[model samples]
Target: MQQTEEHHSYARATWQVVEPYHGAVYFSPEAHARYEELGADNRAGYFASRGAALGPASAELVIGTFYNFNPDLVHRALPAAWQAASPQRFLAARLAGIDATLHRVLGPEIGSAEMLRAAELAQQAARTALRHPQGRPLFAAHAALPWPDEPHLVLWHAQSLLREFRGDGHVAALLAAGLDGIEALVTHAATGAIAAEALRTSRGWSPEQWTQAVQRLCERGWLEQGPDLALTPYGRERRQAIERTTDELADLPYAVLGQASCAELRRLARPFSLALARELLPWAVDRLAAVAD
Candidate 1:
């Protein structure tokens, strides 16, 4: 692998380990309790609390990269929370939610200190890399937000910020290459996770909508014609290019950490990630393996 590929690989490994923990909020009891305290009742309420912290950003902005959620749900959820609180209040609530969820999931022991240390290292790297002006609007906004006091929470928020940073950049890359939200999902379906049917259900896209997106890609010569669509050479190359660009953009932070430090961070984070995966995420091990492949 090339140097950039190596850097991207390690960065992805680090992300995979921490990502499940961040996502645990969706299922965690403590997270729901925090949301209830914040006057939120359902999943939409939780999404609104966190999404509002990204500023008075439009639902279009959130829906673009948050591709899996139904747009109508996001539209409905955002205004209620956004209208009720100032950005500062929303951010505070968001942090509280993260703290509650992580504490419950990770507990007091099980390498919490090591996780904090690794998070600090990763945050430092992300901060150093973010000095440059970039098109990562969501990331830029969150990066400017204040940090939490507790080390574990700090790590969770920092990792959240970095993930948004990378995600925003990836969206930019996708658009530049002429792939829209559904189209991108169509391409992604060609590789991992199953087919367009799975994406349609998971992402709340209707069959007609998915077909339309696939048709668009077909017109562009990126996808082969027919019901069982696959990526043509052009499609494969375009997807690869998008991925490479995203990796390059996201690489700066990991590059700042360098090889040895990056490896060490992964080592420190692995056990926590594994434990969480076993307890919380049934598909996480398979997801990690797919990334490695």
Candidate 2:
């Protein structure tokens, strides 16, 4: 079914509002500690835990699914991370960390009726996503896991599925726009949604590789030369089109769930999202700013 503009807005809104709650594990000290216990360093912890859903996935698999990280960085982390800990162990550690992190950030709210309601609603929408997982390998992998019994954990896991479902579509959109992994990062930085240096370093792209991507974007007339990375008008339009396509692809679950239920989920999830963002997400300012624009 073709998605209406209204449904697209709901899909994007739902994603932005629920993001922090699902994303806290990435920055949670508790989660990091758990991965460390399994002999995985921070990078290994991130790659292993996120990729654990794919079993003992190869670096090529992770690199292809993850879409934007440096392939060398992926190689440095993968099979090695599996050697340090099995995918099952990595999954367990991530859940344990999420449990600890949510308890610390959300406190008494973890057991609230509101939390359960949010969890139930999010899960319903997530189930809708599960039906259409043909090309969404990451989402399909995560969906194959059993649902967590706890309300807060259920909510977190549901959002994880929904986010990855959308993310897979976003990757398709980027590819359709003819952007490679490095070019994707460069164009995103050019939009100023994130500091170029911050994104470049975090993705493990060398300064030289970053410059090359920037030059590629410039040659495509998608970027402008200056002291800093900047997107030309055409670039901005192209990026917007990519985002629109992504939102449309992601609209199915929310559209199936209907607007009112999604609104309630947003309302119930927002406080938790805000609390998690305040405590765990310093980098979210970049994302929040991008949303505002």
Candidate 3:
């Protein structure tokens, strides 16, 4: 296997392997139910639970940190979400939900020795991320939270910190590239990784707004002027550059882990991540399979 110390590839690989395990908290039915009991609907639950780490942050703060969702959508969820549940309550519910979900999805493996080892390595990486909070708001906010005791929960929390660390960097890269939220989604859609309509709907963008963003991309010569949203060659290169920058910014924690430990963490985490993806995020299965290769 290629070592993480070789270059940026290790950082990206680590992210891909662990993402499903960390991200499963969002899609878990147990999490949704907990939020629902607090009087937060799905949208409110999603924004509030994720943003609760920021300590009742405003809609604008969420929009800035989230960096790709519609402002109006964020506005609809905030303050109201806080009113339904305090940040502390939201955070507690989030942890409880994660506990229940992991137990359900991972079963006996949650307490396995391999899990303890993965948690140790992941927490080490997260500590490295903690040292470099500098401009990473979401990551810093999460880093302030107390660490959980269970191996599975520790692994989840550490990966959450690392994911947000990368996410904060990704947002910085997007801003540096001069791509606004809608424009970023437009170009992402043009790459055909996901359907354009799905991206628009998930981000709470209107059809007209989606069309306008497409027009803006076309004006920038980043997209073809046809019915389909296809990237021009230049557009592809620009997109690749943005990803490269994100990877560069995200490499620090893995770099601290060194090649052997990074490889070990990936090896230890892969099966658990794959299990979570199979249970909670079917779309990620093929991508995780490719990484396993």
Candidate 4:
């Protein structure tokens, strides 16, 4: 086995794309918001545990890879097949399905340099030198890839592999709003209720701003629209946990931004001449708990 720590491979065929372990690292603005909320609630631990693992949907990807499922399965399956095939047939089968399939992971054409590179990385990581039902294969490979899209195949495959290595099972019932309308509209009542209260007591926002925001979310199906705004079941589910995330994080000490809500806080308060002063610095960590000092 070539230990990456001792001898790194720069060959394109040797590496794969990578994503961060925690789902919060999805790294979108919304994801950043979620991370902030979770951090404030002292829930960084939730991510700490899964730091380099796959996201919530990892299981499905795993089962798919093992079973040769999904549209791209054949291409994925082919390289591994070649690896295990007899030496005589290896080269002949090397480019199997190269022309027949359009792989989203590898792009529409398998003939591309990128596609070949991916096949090589996956082969080196899991297939090449594979010993059938028994021994752990040596000559392994590794790569840090980008985050997979929701329901992504390669991402799922990578996650499954990680879980097996660690003997960890990624299971949880945290509610996820499909954020699509097919879901029941009634779930968010509680969260909407919370939002409504927040809005009512909200100091800077105008009725129109709050109402417009709520209405926009309602139209987008983030919350249920009604005579009085409230969360749908989905919203309820997320709200319950998101708020808990804040409290969980609050165990650490943070000076409340006096009265500043999240919106009012921003990174690098460079405009404030007193930002260097301990007392007047406007920054707050994610939560009252989880202080870095």
Candidate 5:
């Protein structure tokens, strides 16, 4: 226990030096209390992407993604806020509203009771968040931490959990590849084919590390060694699945969520979807800027 404590002490110092914003959020009294009640094991209210937080920007995006990612949790955590117009909600309600609206505007017409309400709330939030002058700095601060080299930690984690829950081996394998960085390379190639050798040098991967990534994809038959090789039919399908999700998220922007007042726009979800798309594209750009090795 003494040794473990020492390691955490060291980690805290290192984290603060490199990622100070995290220190502020993690040490917040309310955040610690919330995590304690939620429990470390189940990790409710805790984020897979950025862990727990309190500030509005982090709260809105991270908390919003939580509910947006898992519809079932909507009722469990913020039922009153999303389900009805009563006074009871937080970051999750506003985010969920955005997610539901984006989906409706893009796909599917079979709306759930909660979904219809979600659409309404998104528009109200997006417009208000965008219009507020003072809301700019506060909204920008909600931004995520620097993404790792593979920009797929949360995406891969959520997909992996979903596969485990539904027992989907095919996708489980694909998500595994994503986390390991093998999948992202091939996907990036099919889209535009970034020069792998140059990318490796810039990312500072060892020759072996780069080779192994290629080898992993090769073993799965998604890639092969050749003068001008490319992905297979099976590989395209898996990559397509990932691209589709990104395409969906690309439709919403964070700024709209930042300054928007959920109370004022309890029913304007549809128009909000377009505004959100613009926000999401820029947000993704920001995260990719800090991707780690």
Candidate 6:
């Protein structure tokens, strides 16, 4: 139990440092500039640049994992973007986007240097961590990809890969325990990151679809019936178990870092994450708070 808790703490801290990059990339001017150069708009550019790193994967591959954007949104973006530019071109655009965003947000200073150093430490740790069992398809594919030469880019890509590694594992764990995508999302909504209504709207699930999911969970004794939509005791236990499993799966990389090294990575990365929250992208902070909750 204690080991699990320790792993959870390290995983949470690591995520805090890197999570901003995942969301802020969509909002950054640098990312926009790179997208424009690629002859794609923000939505298509985002879908292409990020998806390109995975190779010319199908929309089903993308929608099932990686992105939380509605399936319709992704379908509209892909092949169109691919037709406009090859995956290699988009991959280059993706790196350029990250570079521009980080530079614009962090600027040239000790701050940028520290973030790069943190990325190096994280990449080293993740390299050690990925030696463990990973069952998720997306993570497996990403883990086999080449590492970037630049420390900052290495950090972003490393962290991104690690995040996906854990996410893919979590999805596997969720499925093993019998929660489908909508059920998983509904359970997550119980955490209050975004309202239930917002989750339904954002994911483009119809009201009937959302209601049916809730009913299915209720039938399984995971959630209570009717308007309130609260989790039963079983529901809470199941949710916690899924989270615990995910943390355990995510632990090896941090374990390779050891307690002291994990602490140092957190120390180095925390201020930069905080600066990102305060100076440039408060939405990242808000999202972090939701995830932490």
The whole-model lDDT of each prediction reads 0.70, 0.90, 0.90, 0.28, 0.34, 0.73
The local lDDT score (0 to 100) that residue 70 gets in candidate 6 is 62
Candidate 3, 1-293: lDDT as tens digits:
23343558777888888889999998989999999999998888999999999999999999999999999999999989988889999999999998999999889999999999999999998999998998899999998999998999999999999999999999998998899999999988888887788889989999999999999888988999999889999899999888888888888888888768888988989999889899988888888888742
> How many Å off is the CA of 192 in candidate 1?
2.3
RMSD of each: 3.1, 1.9, 2.1, 20.4, 20.2, 3.2
**80 Cα displacement, candidate 5 (Å):** 45
Q: Residues 21-134, candidate 4, lDDT per residue (tens digit)? A: 112122223333333333311122112212212222132333332221222322333333323323223211211111111132233333444333333333323222122212
TM-score of each: 0.86, 0.96, 0.96, 0.21, 0.30, 0.85
Candidate 1: the clashing residue pairs are: none
Candidate 1 Cα RMSD after full superposition onto the native fold (Å): 3.1
Ranking by TM-score: 3, 2, 1, 6, 5, 4
- Model 6: per-residue lDDT, tens digit, 127-208? 8756753466777766776887777677777787777777887887787779877788888887655578877776667888
Worst 10 residues of 3 by lDDT: 1-10
* Pairs in steric clash, model 2: none
Model 3 error, position 26 (Å)? 1.0
Of the two candidates 3 and 6, the one with more favorable lDDT, higher being better, is 3
Task: Report the lDDT tens digits of candidate 2 across residue range 1-293.
Answer: 66899888877888888888989999989999999999999999999999999999999999999999999999999899999989999999999999999999889999999999999999999999999999999989998999999999999999999999999999999999999999999888877767888889999999999988988888999999876788999999999998888998899989988889888888888888888888888676445445421
Error of 1 at 15 (Å): 2.6
- TM value for model 3: 0.96
* Candidate 5, 1-293: lDDT as tens digits: 12233332322222112121112222233433433433321223334213212242233444333221223332233322222222112233323333343343334432444334443433333333233323223232232222212211222122222221222222333454463433454445544446665545533356676567667777887665564447677777767665444322221222233223222222222223223333333232333233221
